[model samples]
Target: MSRYETVIGLEVHAQLKTKTKIFCSCSTEFGKDPNENVCAVCSGMPGVLPVLNEKVAEYATKMGIATNCEINLKSVFARKNYFYPDLPKGYQISQFELPICEHGHVDIEVDDEKKRIGVTRIHMEEDAGKSIHSAADNASFVDLNRTGVPLIEIVSEPDMRSAEEAIAYLKEVRSVLLYLGICDGNMEEGSFRCDANISVRPYGQEEFGTRAELKNLNSFKHILKAIKYEVDRQIDLVEDGEKVVQETRLFNVDKGITQSMRGKEEAHDYRYFPDPDLVPLVLDEAWVKQWQSELPELPRDKRERFMVEYTLADYDAALITTDRTVAEYFEAAVKAYNGEAKKVTNWVVGELLPFCHEVESEACDVKLSPEKLAALLTLVDDGTISVKIGKDIFRDLCESGDDPAEYVKAKGLAQMSDSGELEAMVDQVIADNPSEVEAFKGGKKKLMSFFMGQVMRLSKGQANPGIVTKMIQEKLS
Candidate 1:
């Protein structure tokens, strides 16, 4: 049997987070009643003129600049003719030949290797209305609220070799969009959706095999599964002497398989023509430079900075910079601690992160400020509080945002690091646990742990365990 390789490309439609619809004055709010947000312009009523939204163009330009794409100085919208009841317009206004961006690429890290995936084009388009189908009643309902919502469809070249690379590309693209604030990148609410074109070919073969388009993949997990299943299905079909047909398929997440929707249509099938209602969008180099200057330090740059400046490991840098809020929080904490990178990372990852997840709050909104957290860690470092006591105080600070120093003083949780005091405590503990002491003398070194625990309990968890253990070892010997 010959081994086959899978090749995949993705068309990611990310709904721009604008306040109003693309070509209308209606609110672009999601979750509204069906057709409530629709207007004559979005509904595709005859004689309705579609005025272009300037923000949409700015966002598209921003994405183009961010992805290192060639921004088309002039881009035009073309009507994509189709007859779907959900699309109030008999034709969807989309860009075909002259898209806003072309020949861009984003670098993605998959399995510790960096790969650049080529972006064929990023075009501006208006979304079609959603159709909800009922399984039991076999009826479909239309929601036009999403119709006319602005979107930038980022089409990637078929450069991905596996499902993992495809997912990494999707994640990097989504992260860039989110950081740019052009799109919210929420997959669940249809704000960000992906359609994958996947095919399988024999290893070392140059010609591409038959490809299937998988739609309705809302989440990253589903995209991976759907692509893998489709690849396997196509490879199996070729192995069984059956040809893989070119068709659009829907991924049934519940069933974990792709079902055929319709045969693929060529681009000319849509009868594309310039939209008469909308004029060509002419962007000057000055405007593109403005949006480019406003772009934030993207994920890759921030990740590298964290590693170099803060001495964070790759995983730590990656985690801290995954979201803007988390990244800012980590940076602020580091600044407060005078560049105690490891301590800041430990507190943020170990304590602040779990607390944020538990309370369903953002890390930026956590009660403890980075300054206070740094101060708390300083207390542990200076032996003002033991590590265990510092943890307790840190939890209190997280709950109340209290000053760590004040809390430690009020709670009497300061560490008893004075050698005289800790030594006396350890001696008392050994005298009290005579039998355990005998076990230690008889080579049951594990009893040392018991002695330390007793000392910690006696000190109310304020004794420095390191000092206590050393003193106990000297006394026993």
Candidate 2:
């Protein structure tokens, strides 16, 4: 219970996955040879008029609908005046007074308590180019390939109280964009980026402390660390009778501290005005409804549905729904095996995710497809193999891309479930380990694991573990 309460709001810029730059015919491919993908229009040569790309509007409106935002039928795009070497036009064209969407909300959970954060507006904009600095030579380079790329800036209300909430809100927005397929959601590649505005006030104070902008937080870990440090710095300033200043700050990755970059700018500072070259974007009600109906089920909705329909717990549902392909993979296996979602979830979350991590590939990219995973789980379900042997079988199937049933039969990995054969082995085990058996009968119940281990070792790791446990209990009792 500190005397201060932190307030946070996030602005996420998601570059839409359009084939071409928003207002030009230039290709939007990344990692092109520096300025290779640039054209006269994208590079902002004089006497060239901009033509709006319909796909940009389509993607932005789709995101608005997905985030439960109000779609402004007649949204205007304005010129945001700024002069930087990377901004080839000297002024970036963006939406201002009449943005494409407004009044949206995203719900997030922290410590199992749900909160709906308000989205103030979602506006369309064109991305500026990159500025490259050379290490060998003391010179700067500007690459205009990224200029004129379609972007939608999602502005959130200042509802977050801590780093966890801000991050949860950011992740939810990224997931929605990813699910929509409008954005690649790659933060490292600059496809998705966030700038946070943070402020603090006394616990019962009605006025807010001046906020500082935190920029260039590429990773989640960096974002979290930055917020924690910023909040503490503001609280300290207030306690020391120092007033916090409104300025832009950069998060230093190596030093793990935020340094002031520049003073925060207001909307009026951008000198926004409607572009005379381009007309207003007028979306009809029928057209907006069409895209709304076509929107995919978002991550949050999918997570909730999994909990109810698949009978999965909150943690499993969240883990599986973290990415679209992972959720699809889980659903495919469940459908193939005809239910048993809990078992499927356990394997997918416990086994599949880690395997994907080890290979440094997406879960959907694995050779172990849903059908194959279903087959492996079926082998365990039918008692053809024990869980221990299934581990080996799963690994072999992944490595060799072989069918599970064939692999089991070819490798002699089937669980030996025969009672008579197992009983004889149990007798041999009990007879050989007299001291352990005596210890087991002398009220040492925990020694059952030792007997089970010996039986497994004697059976060459093919013994049915459940049957071994039963036989050991019968003999010991």
Candidate 1 steric clashes: 0
Score residue 330 of candidate 2 by CA lDDT.
93
Cα displacement (Å) at residue 315, model 1: 1.8
Please provide, for model 1 over 348-464, each residue's C-alpha lDDT reduced to its tens digit, 9 standing for 90 to 100. Answer: 888888888788777777788888888888888888988777776666688798899998899887888889888888888988888988889899988888998999888888888
**CA shift of 251, model 1, Å:** 2.7
Q: RMSD of each candidate?
A: 2.7, 1.8
The candidate that achieves the highest lDDT relative to the unseen native structure:
2
In candidate 2, how many Å is residue 308 off?
1.7
Q: All candidates' lDDT scores?
A: 0.88, 0.91
Lowest summed lDDT window (length 10), candidate 1: 387-396
Q: What is the overall TM-score of model 2 with all chains considered together?
A: 0.95
